[model samples]
Target: MSATTQDAVQHHDHHGPEKGLKRWIFTTNHKDIGTLYLLFALIMLFVGGAMSLVIRAELFQPGLQFVNPDFFNQMTTLHALVMVFGMIMPAFAGFANWMIPLMIGAPDMALPRLNNWSFWLLPFAIIMLAMTLFLPGGAPAAGWTLYPPLVLQTGDAFPFMVFSIHLLGISSIMAAINIIVTILNMRAPGMSLLKMPLFVWSWLITAYLLIAVMPVLAGGVTMLLTDQFFGTSFFQAAGGGDPVLFQHIFWFFGHPEVYIIILPAFGIISHVIPTFSRKPLFGHDSMVFATGSIAFLSFIVWAHHMFTVGMPLAGQLFFMMATMLIAVPTGVKVFNWIATMWKGAITFETPMLFALAFIVQFTFGGFTGLMLAIAPADFQYHDSYFVVAHFHYVLVNGALYGAFAGVFYWLPKMTGHMYNDKLSKIYFWISTFFINVTFFPQHFLGLAGMPRRIPDYATQFTDFNAMSSIGAFGFGLSQLLLVYIVIKTIKGGEKATGEVWEEAQGLEWTVSSPPEYHSFETAPDIK
Candidate 1:
């Protein structure tokens, strides 16, 4: 055997993972922490999915059958919070934990103890968030945006929710710092920034975005807390604080927050499309530049979300044009993916299927977003179901679907067991088709003037709303199949090879399937 192989084994496997529950609570291993992040995200996925079901059921017949308006708002608020905070973002972080060090030829994150702390913070934060629901006056119902005046009046859930958000923000900041430090300092010799994998590149940019913006969210929410208790009037108009200032601050964080959830998805797709297409990623440098541009643009487009808030015409025009400008870099990404597929020996694995669907559906969301970017056109779409449909298309089909693609792409390697191909494809098809059914009609309803965040609507909206509810249920059930498929693969199935996908590029595929508890003991030279 080569000296290098022996050295790798000696260095990487010196202390493998400990056994049982103690292994989890006290572990500093990156793989272990990544697994914890994923498991937590999975559990949150179901919890948030349940909240969505409540919403769908209530909106099913259009008369609020199951929940009253207050509870209905609670469902909406919690669903967005849990899904965005608890499910999507952490899932990406989980991927970062599991794959980043391996991809960069590092044995572990730069800050392993901080990694443990960041992940552990989530469960407590989630518990605090959940606790808010059962205590006194129910969960915060001002939507995930948590705009002021209305937010100040929420029940017992308010303080807990704010505190939970603070915990989450702190956790996110720590995780981002770990990612930045590891990516910057731990890469193998000969691996320069330009040569890094797209996933790593995507992450570096996202970490910066997180570091820059999450504090703003924390501060905004803190001000809300102060308004609630300390008698500050940061958002109270009667006290001379303009409520719109809160929108300005919140969206500053909020818009970038959307990109934080999505940039990793771009990284995931960059890898997946290349693997299935059996070719190098097209426009590799361009993808990097485009990602950077998107990150930069995310900072300036925050105001587009508040076009209805009565800003000056000049401010409106500036934000309107800035929001539309984002489409350029975003469009470049979409173009590169398709170009990567062009003239390649393509195969439609489960991951590729989802990737292809993401291109179509996510672009659809982008188009709608552009429509909403027009200051004039937004006047009509603002606060309507159209806005609702637009974001879900992006979040659910874009971020969440991209996540599904990544998980499927890496599942075999992670589990060392090939999932049921038939079942995986079935899960994909059901999820894609029903997701459209669930959210597509909302576009029509919004154009027909159906306002969002309301429990009941006019009779004209009944048919579409019922169809959406049915689709929501179907989409919700489809996820169970994914959960089952994941379990079945992990328990036992066909063993996966070191290179799980055909010609899957990067240092990660060079590692063993179900890589050692401590991966990459010795850094690999990136030739």
Candidate 2:
């Protein structure tokens, strides 16, 4: 082609995004889509946050004060569902969409249009899920596990819940496939697998986990659908179907689902800690291996969640040992983070504060997890507030905090302005303080033998429950500060340079702040 003709084509391709809603609806730009995912997840954070407050409110004095028992159960069930699928997963996806291509020096995700479709599916799925609460029997209240017999009791909400899950599973798998293909096929020259950023590597592993287990979850729920509507007895004891079989299928997916929510958080922490510490990651290659090891161990340890339901002694022992073994690699990661910070110029930036909290609180969660891993001990902990405390620490303080850190760390780059540091710090301290107040007391409540999912509790559980409820209210309100900071950053603030953080490293920092519409019209050379 002539030079003039070639230049025209290049100019057309490099034009800015279309104006108005059409750009968001039809554009395949990764950054635009990433923004959409982040905004959506933020909205969900509030939605799920509201539901949690209702739960804490009811449990405050434990006399069925704010909501009825059935509605309270709905709150618990829907809160978990929205937070897991809506809030955390999509927030991580936002990170992947925005950062992966930037990190790997790729122009865009390998499947840009598929990326659009994957995200679009989520709102529809969430709508279906939320609509269930108004349905004849209220939303699925068998807890997020959606175990049968009990879940089978759900009314018109059953089919909605099932199909919504199917939509979520499909969305997750597509995103995973896109991430896998992008990383494997689109990395710039010299950006080998081993050289990829920790965040990129973590997402790569997480995508694989998503692809592997989402189908299992989809199948489990599909069976539930069939059993409910099509006369299948997959879990009906009267029809010779064992309910325990469903537990096996659900936890097979559920166990790894925890890692799926968390591994990306792990990735974010890996990046944030090193940047603030002004040090190279202490053990980059070992971090990668430990991540893979955790993923592998995640699969074998599902049975530990099922020990209370009954299993052969040998089966229990195998699962118990496998669960405990995960600690080795997890401990390796913790040590690596600590080592990276040891003897370095560490500054407690807002991002660093959240990351440090993640490491410390997540370790607390992990220890509790280990305690639950003992098959003998699990029999006592099962279905109690203790179990609730363990996972919340991992999810809220661990995964959610990691997401918060990433937002602060990258906000400057994404929006071309530095966030309000003072407000952010205040937000951080309040959130941290309240999150502990909310979940830590649950550990005590569980030890005191307070069963979970109950609307009213024994008088003996009142003091701790009241404290937890107060913390829950404080934590939920504190999140509004995040919304304010994000908006204030986007509208206007002190301008940020390409390298937003002093020690920031990667292809992303090499680009202009709030990188150009196409990110990279030409691929970056990674040396």
Number of clashing pairs per prediction, in order: 0, 0
For the record, the alpha-carbon RMSD of candidate 1 to the native fold, in angstroms, is 1.3
Cα RMSDs of all predictions? 1.3, 2.0
Displacement of residue 393 (Cα, Å) in model 1 is 0.5
Error of 1 at 191 (Å): 0.6
Residue lDDT tens for model 2, 1-527: 15456557788677789999999998788899899999999999999999999999889896878788899999999999999999999999999999999999888999999999999999999999999999998998999999889999998899999999999999999999999999999998888899999999999999999999999999999999999889999999998898999999999999999999999999999999999999999999999999999999999889898898889999999999999999999999999999999999999999999999999999999999999999999888999999999999999999999999999999999999999899999999999999999999999999889999999999999999999999999999999899999999999999999999996888899998998877655667667
Residue 165 of model 2: what lDDT? 97
lDDT, each prediction:
0.93, 0.94
TM-score to native of every candidate shown? 0.98, 0.98
lDDT of 2 at 390: 97
Poorest stretch of ten by lDDT in candidate 2: 1-10
Task: Find the 10 residues in a row with the least total lDDT in model 1.
Answer: 1-10
**Model 1 agreement with the true structure over 65-87: per-residue lDDT tens digits:** 78899989999999999999999
